[model samples]
Target chain A: MAVFKPATSNLLHIEVINAIINAIVSGELKPGDHIIEQHIAQEMQISRAPVREAIRELAAQDIIQFIPRKGAYVAPLDPRNIEGIYLLRSYLEGLAARLAAPRLTETDLNEMYLLNYQMGEASLKNNVDTFINLDLQFHDFICQHCEHSQLKKMIDGVQLQTKLFMNMSKWHLAAHSELHREMNAHEPILEALRARNQEEAEMKMREHIVMAGNRLLEYLVDNKSSKNSKKEDTETVKN
Target chain B: MAVFKPATSNLLHIEVINAIINAIVSGELKPGDHIIEQHIAQEMQISRAPVREAIRELAAQDIIQFIPRKGAYVAPLDPRNIEGIYLLRSYLEGLAARLAAPRLTETDLNEMYLLNYQMGEASLKNNVDTFINLDLQFHDFICQHCEHSQLKKMIDGVQLQTKLFMNMSKWHLAAHSELHREMNAHEPILEALRARNQEEAEMKMREHIVMAGNRLLEYLVDNKSSKNSKKEDTETVKN
Candidate 1:
């Protein structure tokens, strides 16, 4: 189990939810990991009531699954789940880019440019955490300005799930070179936005997202056989 | 105030949620209408606690809005909010059609065809309720077999909201001819599915959804000026 510190003093359940999500996104918790509410309560020095409620909330979001008599475990992932996330994200962010293109102010474009540049710098230093954070900001900037509240909300949820599963499989560690390629892929999107070319921006954004999904899928497939054979061994050792 | 029967004896709060959602979809509850928990509790013969919880749940889903010290109201309509819903639905249903193309059974295709044909019959009989119900089934049938759980979940939520707002505006009251046109729109999607043409199915489904969105947008825009002028009168009389 990952060590958890008490989070901010908003509603205790919401804080617990954030802590669990953060743990999953940081690769400290992997799919199929059993989540014991009591242990989490003890770790955070909070009552089990809030921890249990947080687990229920996560389960509602499909981030955790409960088996009869088995209690709650982190949702076991399927490749299709990841693909579904990326495919949906691709269409939505593509829509966002198109909407944001005509609406982009100079400041918005410059902010995105800076974020992309920082992502490249992070990749160069092999700082996966910084790169990932910057990557989220780069995408989120366009989405925020897309002028669609519904789209932004959907994208935010999907993006977090994407990070959670990607980190579970060590997605960043497997693709150092690909990180640079991915960071560089943002240039065409930036140029399209700068030019206020909606169609070009939408097309480029979709392609960029699909490319990343494909790379992750390839990595998962290539590692699956070895991973499957060692799965039991790993589970026993890790737990 | 809309009369609500006590729903199934599941959790009282969940039953309250269903009653409220049903009222909205049936047009008994209109946008910007205040939600009084005490009245709902009285109507349903339940305690105010469950009604309050239900309001909180609806507020979380964006179906209800809270104005501090003013209590809860059904979320007000915005053209862009409707557009956002339809646009996202278009892309998702398109993806669902594509994924379901090869996987659809003979029975599944036949069921869709029957549903489409039934929608036409309902339209010819000028039964808006039956037509709308069939329309949902037609699209939902395709989506259910799409082999993607996440996509189905999203479409379900978006579709419900679509119906809620559309019914609020009495969408069927304004367009008899367009009902036939929209019913015919499902034909190409059905044909594409029968042919097992994934790309063609995707394109047709997207076009079908976009056409519906555009038609609704046109209706809303044309009605806007008059509606704006009458807004105060309508609110006073309706409440």
Candidate 2:
């Protein structure tokens, strides 16, 4: 686990949980790796109880799995699970876009526009992280105006899951190059919302999610291929 | 907690988790009740560790909240959370219904029809539990035919959260009476899907979810009133 010792007097479990989640999301903890509580506690200089609590918490979110007698392991990202999450996200987000269209204030539109511009700047400067952050901000800005708290939470939960995939795919040059196209896609969506055309907004949002999902899947396939190749090379060298 | 003999050796944590969940769902463990791990373990004739593990699992799902020093407590069903879940479910299930409609085989249709019929029968017999089970079966059947694993998982998760509200509402007679209407609502959805009319299928499914959400909210309001009145009566007697 990535060691960053910080003061943790309150909510020790939550703090530890976030650290482990960040480690997993940042690729410091690979899938199927055993998460020994003692190791984590020692690294963080905390008791094993809090670390154990954090592991259990992660397991509940399906981010990890605990086998009795065996230890806790990072949950593997199953493509099927990704597909399921994206599919639901697309439909819910499409609804959010539709609901937000008629109700989107001028301020909401302006905020989205500003975010989109910043995203473009980030893309031009080849700042993938900034571009990604802005991209998330733009979508979130629209969701903020949706007036449906339930929809927003559901979308946010799925978005968190997708973020892991997004981080993994960030290493791909083509993925970074698609930032401009992504920004363009948001323009039509914002325009539709500004025009109070719910159908158009919903359609655009669905298309955006579908396109993103497809791209992420492609990146995953490529990543898997490279990983397999590397493994084969190691085996051949050993032989 | 419902007493279960310790015949089953494995799945200890799951069993404990299910027992506690059942208490919450059954209203035996009311919201705000501090979950005593020792008390629960003694009731279920299990060790404290499994109970603690179960509590952690529940906390992760937001079914309960864990307090340091103070024990875990059943999470109160927040109306906002319910609304958010319903909104997301509406969109996702709408998509599933639309997708499943055209792809639904004769077997799928027959299965759904049977489930619906069984739901009606259970409702007529005033077997709310049986009716609810059939109702879930009907929806799950639709999701299975939808052929989207991601959609199914999302739907299932949303349904799980809604179960608490659904159980509370089950106490009301009108909620029980609406079973037939709910079954009828599925007819047009199935018809639209069978006819390969995706738009109609989607519309019907969305309508179904919206109506269910509305009904559940109304039921929750009534449940709250009844609970308040009962407390008032007790206070009056004490005075």
Candidate 3:
């Protein structure tokens, strides 16, 4: 759930797509915000051709939307879809962890141990961004070690959706106390993998994702309900 | 596994995407076949703009591949990737069937029952196309009614890979005897769904996919081994 770095490819359209994605990930461009093709072209100091092509590609990827006469906008993070993303990620990540278990080198386990230790320090300092970076790095290591490209791709797509709501930076700051809960979840998965227990590794990883997803959704719902009540109070005052 | 009817939208690019996919699915275009933008444009009587655009989109989706100097080709269906696809599909489809069990109406069960019955007939008649279509239909019904768009999308993407190998025609023709095994697999899924047992439904669906995947891979491996042996025999004869 760390901030998305733009793709490092040299292709202009790909660069444009990553730049536009960077804006959305950074909160500079919120969901449902109209994407002006001209504005993006101007901002990137590039011609509209690659920018236009980027938008078309993004739309095809479901990363953006196109309205007939209205141009494109960022796709909103639907709570329902977010839930589904977590469920899919849980199974897929579990599969990744399971597959990577036998293949994990001693150096891989050592790195994970270091990452877990860093996560603990970041939690104590209340540095959410650093904590999330480590968390994503840890997961990414497992995904990278996975033998299957298709499975890795599926996991990456769902995790991107998770970024829409969690945004990596903000959520970790807000949920400092809950970091221990996640720490608890990660322990079992790491242990299972270290022990090379594929079944346990898969289930524990799945459980970790499901727990994190439920916690995030609960936070979102609570946040929404509080905002709704505040809006009602302001409306009453106006009346 | 049925012929991919193109998207009905007025978008020219979507139509182009589907037309190209249809050629791939129908075996008119084999893996690694070059997709000539101007050729398709001339064939479809449209400009090259949309065809070019469609190629980019499909490349992003992994349906096509772009090589720097070689131009775009259909993404080859690797034996390794096919195994990964089935494993992922098993989990996702199982998830769909689980979510769908409690939500399935009487009509849904009855329809599935009829579909299952028809699958038996197709197997007995050695009707591969009909069998594959019905197989897709049965799975699609569960995915459509699963109440999760994201899960359905993931399932659909993996199933597309299956088409690369099966293509609804040749595989069935060669593996005629194995059709009955598939029939045996479908029976338990229907029974579990009809009984409204969520746990049983999920496990059964997962098991069914795993079983079918194993059979397909076994058949493919056998085919490859035989071909390689025949090559060795021909070389010996030449010597």
Name the candidate, 1 or 2, with the larger DockQ value.
2
Runs in model 3 deviating more than 4 A are A1-9, A66-70, A168-172, A175-177, A228-239, B1-9, B68-70, B168-175, B228-239
Top candidate on DockQ is: 2
Per-candidate TM equals 0.86, 0.80, 0.87
Tens-digit lDDT string for candidate 2 (B1-239): 24434525586888987787777777676666678887777767788888888888776556787777887988766765566567677777888887787788788777777777776777677777787777777777778878865467567656766677778777574444666655466677767876879899888888888888877777667667656623212211110
DockQ of the candidate models in sequence: 0.39, 0.52, 0.48
In TM-score terms, candidate 1 sits at 0.86
- Which regions of candidate 1 fall more than 4 Å away from where they truly are? A1-10, A34-61, A65-72, A169-178, A229-239, B11-13, B36-61, B66-72, B169-178, B228-239
In model 1, the clashing pairs are none
Candidate 2 vs 3: which has more DockQ: 2
**Weakest 10 consecutive residues, lDDT, candidate 3 chain B?**
B230-239
Per-model lDDT = 0.78, 0.74, 0.76
List the lowest-lDDT window of 10 residues for candidate 1 chain A: A230-239
Per-residue CA lDDT of model 3 for A1-239, tens digit only, reads 21223234667777887787778888767677777776666666666777878888777556787776689988776677767778878888998998899999899999998999898887777777787778888888899888987778777766666666668336644555666555545778889989999999999989888888888878777677655422222111110
Interface RMSD score of each model = 2.9, 3.7, 2.3
Q: Where does candidate 3 clash, by residue pair?
A: none
Candidate ordering by DockQ (highest first): 2, 3, 1
